[model samples]
Target: LDPFVDWLQKRKIPRGLGIVIIYILLFAFVSLAVILIIPPISKEVTQISENFPLYYEKIVNGFNAFKSNLESPENTEQVQQGLNSLGENLSATVSNVAGAIFSIFGGLFSVLLVLVLTFYFTINEEATRGFIYTFAPSNIHPYINSLHTRIQKKLGSWLRGQLILSLVIFALTFIGLTILGVPYALVLAFIAGILEIIPTIGPLIAAIPAAFFAFLQSPVMGVSVIILYIIIQELENHLIVPKIMSKSVGLNPLIVIISVLIGAKIGGVFGALFAVPVVTAISVFLRDIIEKKVEAETKLVQ
Candidate 1:
């Protein structure tokens, strides 16, 4: 957005007018996407609701048969309890995910707040920086600005890269699911794309429903779905993440996994979504501080 505004400014456009133009373009793009996507998703959701009972019956029957075959009563009871616990946990997880999604997309107030803040910050970019600088010592103002700029660039790069990653996952998942003759490929792909934001655990969670639906058709189909997701995950971890996120975040995969887990534990889905950027910002500051300390130590030794 800033780059686009800068381009417009170079063309002798007023900054405020340029912002409005960018906002209009963004709104138009979002509108077009919603128009194109919503209908198919709605249909898929309706179909899922209509067919869910059949799927549930099949699962119950299968579980019952498995329980009947168990030789020991105690073992069967333990298994039942484990399954009941699993169901409860899964239910809670689904509820949490749905709530998070609704909070993010359904909350008009949140969206408007973000827009307003962004507009204010962008419009008063220099003034905002000056205001912030006023709180710090004048000698360290340059350092603070440099740190801010670094964090901003990293965050911007990360956001752009994440959007690209999600689109790529969506396309790949859609193509794979379609080729495999899975029902609700579009919906599943959309889930895959959206969940790609959560790093390590998201792909695994996205695969569950896909595999469940595929398993309803055939065991082979279920296995294939799982395999497809695994392949995609491998590709994402080995190829896509390295190429897309490495430059932007510059954190090891282990660190990212840890940060995401910590964030999710603390703040749920939205926290996981922002964990990488927040960590990146901290890393930038830490690096700067370490460098300054090392320089001071070297000067003292000299």
Candidate 2:
């Protein structure tokens, strides 16, 4: 079956038939993914949209109640000061929230556009590569081609691994939240899934609201939520990440952190989403160059 598919990919089949097959496979895979994931996603998004203000109210009320329970006059003063600051920045915060929503929708559109473009390129991979190579100098064309292929494989693997990781985290989060009777479990879990793209800090950020909500229910529950999040993070790091992302990139933790920070600084969420893959591509190309140079010098000495 693999050999036959390779032969078909090499264009032994009629062009129209091959195109049909490609579309059929693409459709089937996409359909399967959507069928499996879209219902929970739609439910989560709908619930969040409808109840966001309610959740906000809960958080505000929780904070206010906690503030009232403070014994020290100094503590009350600090709380009042914090409230005043929050009020003063309310308009700016609202504006930032609107901008973030706009950015998220824009990013979603861009993702769809990219997926469409990728499908076209996948169907015409050789032609696309050839077109790119036409811009390169003849002497360096082979090197460029090799580098492109390596980058493509690295990025493709990374993307698939990332999707799997995110889905797993989302499922784990939703299940845990549901068990813990956390309100907005679906919404929080969705956020966790989306933030999983941001690498090291993503899970921690996802855990914040989960813990806060859990804390709102009870201090003990909150503590439990924190512990749950820590365990999930451990599982993701020690088990899921090793299995899924082991082949994707070779960058060390320090490089990954710096790249994520720089990416977020430059392009916000979109930049951060792409940081690891971009770094991986650059690292792979540079390593290849160094290896070639070393080989040349060794040959010269011999």
Candidate 3:
């Protein structure tokens, strides 16, 4: 939004008008996406619900057969206990996700508050920056400004990169699922794209329902779906992450994974969503401090 406004400003448009135009454009894009996407997703969800009984039957049969094959009573009991625990955990997770979604939609006041704040900040970006700088020591103002700029740049890059990554994953998953004749391709792909925000466990979680649906169709199809997910995961890890995320965050994969886990542990979904950017900001500050310390040490030695 800022970039678009800046472009318009460079083209001789007033900042006020530029902001209005950007807002209109943003609204239109969101409206168009909802209009184009909602119907198919609704239909897919309906179909899934209608066919859920059959899928459930297949799952039950598979589980029963596996249990029967386990001859040792003790092992069989352990497996049953594990399955029960898994079911309970899955139920709780689903409930939490559903609640979160509902809460987001229900919180109109919160959403409007955010929009209002964004508008205020965007219009007063420079004033806001100067105001913040007033709190810091006058002598270190330059260092503080540099640090702020670096953090803002990294965060902006990260946002753009993440959006690109999600879109790419969505397209790729939709195509793969369509080719494999999977049900609810759009919804599943959307899920995969959205979950791509979570670091290590996201893709794995996205694959579960996809593979489960495929397995309901056939064992071979299930295996194929799993393979497809693995291939996509590998591509994302090796090619996509390197190309898109490497320059944006400049954090190691291990750091990202750990940050996400910590964030999730602390604040659940929203924490995980923001973990990387928060870490990036902290890293920038730390790097600046380290550089300043090294310079001082060098000066003392001289």
Highest lDDT against the true fold, candidate = 1
- List RMSD in Å for every model shown: 3.7, 4.7, 3.6
> Model 3, residue 248: displacement in angstroms?
1.5
lDDT of 3: 0.81
Q: After superposing candidate 3, which stretches have Cα over 4 Å from the reference?
A: 63-100, 107-112, 251-278
- Winner by lDDT between candidate 3 and candidate 2: 3
* lDDT (C-alpha) at residue 80 in model 3: 73
Off by more than 4 A, model 2: 1-72, 83-102, 132-142, 250-280, 299-302
| TM-score for each predicted model, relative to the true structure | 0.82, 0.73, 0.81
Question: Would you list the rank order by lDDT, best first?
Answer: 1, 3, 2
RMSD of 1: 3.7
Worst 10 residues of 1 by lDDT: 90-99
1-302: candidate 1 lDDT, tens digit per residue: 67788899999998889998999998899899899987898688667766665765676677789988989999988987887686566556544654665676654554566677778888888898899988988998888888878888777777788899999999999999999999999999999998887667889899999998999888999999999999999999899988887777556556778997898688666556667768888989998889989999999999
Q: Could you give candidate 3's per-residue lDDT for residues 19-82 as a string of tens digits?
A: 8887888789978988998779868866765665566566667778998988899998887788
Clashes of each: 0, 0, 0
